[model samples]
Target: MEIKAYSRITADKMVVNGSTVYSSSDGENINLTDLYRHLGIDYPKFFKMDNLCKAGFLGAETIIRDAGMDTVTPKKDCDIVLFNSTSSLDDDIAYNNTIEDDANYFPSPSVFVYTLANIVTGEIAIRNKIMGESSFYVLKEFSSSIIYSVVKETAQETSANAVLCGWADFLNNTPDVLLMLLQRTGDGKIQFTAENINKLYR
Candidate 1:
C-alpha cells in the first residue's frame, strides 16, 4: 500500500498527559492541546495514560481526519495496525509510581486498562466505529515486513481497501511517533519484503 498521511511527535521535555503530573525527562511539558494546534488539528474528544496508546490513537485519528477522510463512522471498510517499541512503558511507570507511594497509593482500574500496546487500535476503532480487523506489534525499531504482513492479512481477511499502520514509541520520556495511512494499490506496492525493511532502516 501507499502512504497517504503521516505525523511525527518527538517530545523531549513535556508533561505526561492523562497520567500523573510528572515533568517529562526533558523537562518540557507538551500540552496536548498545543501539540494539536501546532499540527493544525482540533483536539480529540478523548485525551489522557489511559498514556501512549491513547495519544498514538489521537495522532492517527488526527492524521486521518486531516487527510479529509470521513474518519468517524467510515462508510467503507478499513483496518488499523499499530506498532511500538516500549509497549506502554510510560503507563507502567505511571502505575508503578502511583503504587510506590506509601501514603498515596490508589491505582485506578481505568488507568490500568491502557497498559497494552494495542489499546490505540481500540481507541481508533471505537472513535471511527471501524469494525474491521485491528492489530498491534512491538519492536526495537521499524519492521516493514511485520507491518506489510499485518496489512496484507487484514486486507485479505476484512476485504479492506486500505490500512492505517504506524510506528509509535516512547523512549525515556520522549515520545517518538510516526503514524501513516497506507492505501493498498498495485502501483503503491513496495514488495514489503524482509530484504527491503532491513535495508530501508539501515
Candidate 2:
C-alpha cells in the first residue's frame, strides 16, 4: 500500500498534496466554519461537530477529494484508523469547566458527545458512508510502529483495501492533522512503512 494523497490542517493553514490551500496569520485556533465555506462544501452538520471531528472530517474529505474521486470505495473496503495524543482532553476540559462551578453549571449534550476521541471516526465514517472497521488510539506520543502495525493488522484481518489513517489531534485549540489516503494499489509514490510514516509525520 501507499499514500495516494494527504492533507495537513494547522493553526493558520490548510495544505493538500503539498500545496497550500489556505493560509493566514490568525494565530493558533482554526476556524472550521470558514474553512467549510471556502471548500464550497454544503454539509450542514459540520456546524454541530466539535473541533476534533471537524479536523478529522476536513482532513479526510480533502485528501479523498485531492485523490480525484467522486464515488468513494465501497463501505466494507474502507477503514478509518486515527491517533491522538490528548484523546478528548480539549473537549473534556471544556465540558468540565462548563460544569465545574455549581452556581453556573451547564451540561450541554452537544459538548458531551465530543468527549470521546473515537466519535471523530464515527462522524467521518457516516459522512463517507463507510461501514468497515473503525478504530481510534490514544498515545502519550506519536508512534509510527503502532500506526504501521495496527493498519497492517487491520488490512490483514478485514477486506480493507483503502484505509484512511493518520494523526488528527486538536489540542489547545490548534489542529495538527495529517490524513493519508492509503490504497493497496496506487502509483507507489512512497511505499507504506514505519520509516516512511515517521518521516512524513515530521
Candidate 3:
C-alpha cells in the first residue's frame, strides 16, 4: 500500500504530509475546537464529541481534505483502523466523576456515550461516510508493527480500496494524533511499512 496522505495534530499545531499547515502562537494553548475553527469545518456535531473523538476527527478530516478525498459520496471501499494507548480514559474519568458521588450523582449520557474508544472510529466514519470496516485497538503503547499488520490484514481480507489508519490519543487536554490515508495505487512516495510508519509518527 502507498500512503497517499497523512496528517499529524499535536497540542500546538497541525501538520499535513510533513508540512506545518497550522500552528499555535507562542505560549498559546490550542485545543481541538481551535483547530476545527482554523480548518473552517462547519460540522456542529463536533462540539458534542469528547476530546478523543475530536482529536481523531480533526486528524482524519485534515488527511481526507489534503488528499482531495473530501466528497459528499460515501467511500464504501475504505476502511478505518485506529489505535490508542489510553482508550477512552479521558471520558471514562469524566463519566466516573459524574457517578462517584450519590449526593450529586448524575450519569450523563453524553459523556457516557464516548466511554468506548472505538466511538472515535465511528464518529470519523459517520462524518466521512465511510461504509467499510472500522476498528479500534488499545495497546500499552503505539506500535507501528501492530498498525501495519492490522491494516494489511483488513485490506486484504475486505478487499478494501483504501484505508485510514493510525493513532489518536488524547488525555488531560493533550492531543497526539496521526492519521494516514493508504491505497493500493497512488502517486504517494511513502511506502506502507512499519518502519516508515514509526518514523513518521515520531
Quantify all predictions' global Cα lDDT against the true fold: 0.63, 0.85, 0.91
Residue 81 lDDT in candidate 2: 91
TM-score of decoy 1: 0.74
Candidate 1 C-alpha lDDT tens digits along 31-95: 45555445454435555535576457656766677556665556357788788778888787777
Best by lDDT: 3
* Pairs that collide, model 3: none
Model 2 misplaced regions, further than 4 Å:
26-29, 69-74
The CA-based lDDT of model 3 is what? 0.91
Runs in model 1 lying further than 4 Å from the true structure = 12-31, 39-44, 185-202
Q: Model 2 over residues 25-117: C-alpha lDDT tens digits? A: 556456877888888887889899888998889998888777765435557788899998989888998899889999998898889999999
Which ranges of candidate 3 are over 4 A from the true structure? none
TM per prediction: 0.74, 0.93, 0.96
The clash tally of candidate 2 reads 0
TM-score of 2: 0.93
Each candidate's number of clashing pairs is 4, 0, 0
Worst 10 residues of 3 by lDDT: 25-34
